[model samples]
Target: MKKDKPKYKQIIDAAIIVIAENGYHQSQVSKIAKQAGVADGTIYLYFKNKEDILISVFEEKMEVFVENLQQIIEIDASASEKLFKMIENHFSVLASDHHLATVTQLELRQSNLALRLRINTILKNYLILLDSILREGIENGEFEQIIDIRLARQMIFGTIDETTTTWVMNEYKYNLVDLTPKVHRLLLNAIKA
Candidate 1:
């Protein structure tokens, strides 16, 4: 009997767990196959190699993230409200998906330089959205017009990233959603008019 073609997403999901548990360097194809409950050979059918699997995971998750965030930001609302929603969405999504959060925050960063660069490109959309919100705030006189957009973007992204990573590292002992308001406050302090 012919073996079934493995589900690509299932493989990717399993890869996240295996990578998170074992670390990226130690996560072999066989480990992913085992975690995914498919034969080792089945992985080759879906992905060219481990690198392909990692890249696919990032791309797929980010696609969903950008789509949802785009819709939320499009609603008629002030820049501050939009910024709060953006920060909340980012924190909530990752906090809700612990496995994916671990994979992204810890495991994926273990990949070699080339893979890291690709991950950065995939994540650029999120940064762009943050910058757009900052621009809107500046335009509406809600934020300091003289603030450097790039620097403000970095601060926003960096703060959220560090906060999430810290939460993950601590095994998510606290409510991440609660941090959204505080994060929004600090961001506003830095850029607000």
Candidate 2:
């Protein structure tokens, strides 16, 4: 219900900036409220606490991310092309939004075990998309028949995740999006038939 409200998105975007700037541990609810231009008490109406805000931020961003990926994959193209587009799109979006890049690639990883578990749960749907791509590749002979789908998904996701994290940690010195081709090629080559 609240997720559909304009204020909900406002708080989520505000939480990203606050958490990115202050680090999640140091980001206070009041800071997020100020960033969102809402009263601190107003945050509670949408979120239960700071952890809720963090989770919601990830959930909201990933929902959009997965939706975009689904649309990208649905186009009439080979699995390899879809996978390339996935890598390219993922890098481009994060490269364009430094705050989101920092929050997703860095701040989100600093949470506690329970929080990480929840984050992983949210991440499952995204992984399933990757798995579907890999399966398609194998079925169509675009990828090697011997390639293990699960391991391939992990490698693809981990490579992209770590690459973005490194770029964010380095303060975006170079064009992260530029690395997409090379990353995509490397991952594709590993599984190519």
Candidate 3:
């Protein structure tokens, strides 16, 4: 119910900007509230604390990633085509939002181990969706049946994540979306039968 409130999304979006600009350690709850144009106390209505806000940001954004990937799976296409679209979708989502890219790629990784664990748990849904793509590929003879699903998932996710991180680190001077096809090619070559 609280999450369905407009102010909830406002705070989350504001938190992304605040965290991306100020870094997680330097970002304050009041700063997020101010950015959201609400009183500092309003943030408490939806989140338990600053950490909760950070975790919520990941959970909320990851839902979109999972949902989009789900649709890609449903489209009538070969595993290779599906995988290419998945990479393009991933890159496009992050590339289209530089602030979100900064928050997810750089800011989020700066958290403590406990926060990392929580973030990784939120990531599992996205990874599971990726696994479905991989499994479909293997089943349809598009990918090598000898490939281990878990390792293949890790390789694919890790490659996508690291490439995005590198782009962020370089201040996004390059066209990240343009790299999608290249990433897809390398990943496909690695796993394709």
Task: Report the C-alpha lDDT of model 1 over 1-193, residue by residue, as the tens digit.
Answer: 1123448778988998888888888889999999999999988888889998889889888887787778767988988999899889889889888988998888887789999999999999978877888888999999998999999988988898889999999999999889999999988888889
Residue pairs clashing in model 1 are none
How accurate locally is residue 17 in candidate 2, as Cα lDDT from 0 to 100? 92
All candidates' TM-scores? 0.93, 0.98, 0.98
Better of 1 and 3 by lDDT: 3
Q: Model 2, range 36-89, lDDT digits (tens) per residue? A: 999999999999999999999999999977998999879999999999889988
lDDT of model 1, residue 55: 92
Q: How far is candidate 3 from the true structure (C-alpha RMSD, Å)?
A: 0.7
lDDT of 3 by residue, 113-182 (tens): 9999999999998899889989899998999999999999999999999999999999999999899889
Model 2 Cα displacement at 146 (Å)? 1.3
- Model 1 segments more than 4 A misplaced: 1-6
Residue 159 C-alpha lDDT in model 1: 93
Candidate 3, poorest ten consecutive residues by summed lDDT: 103-112
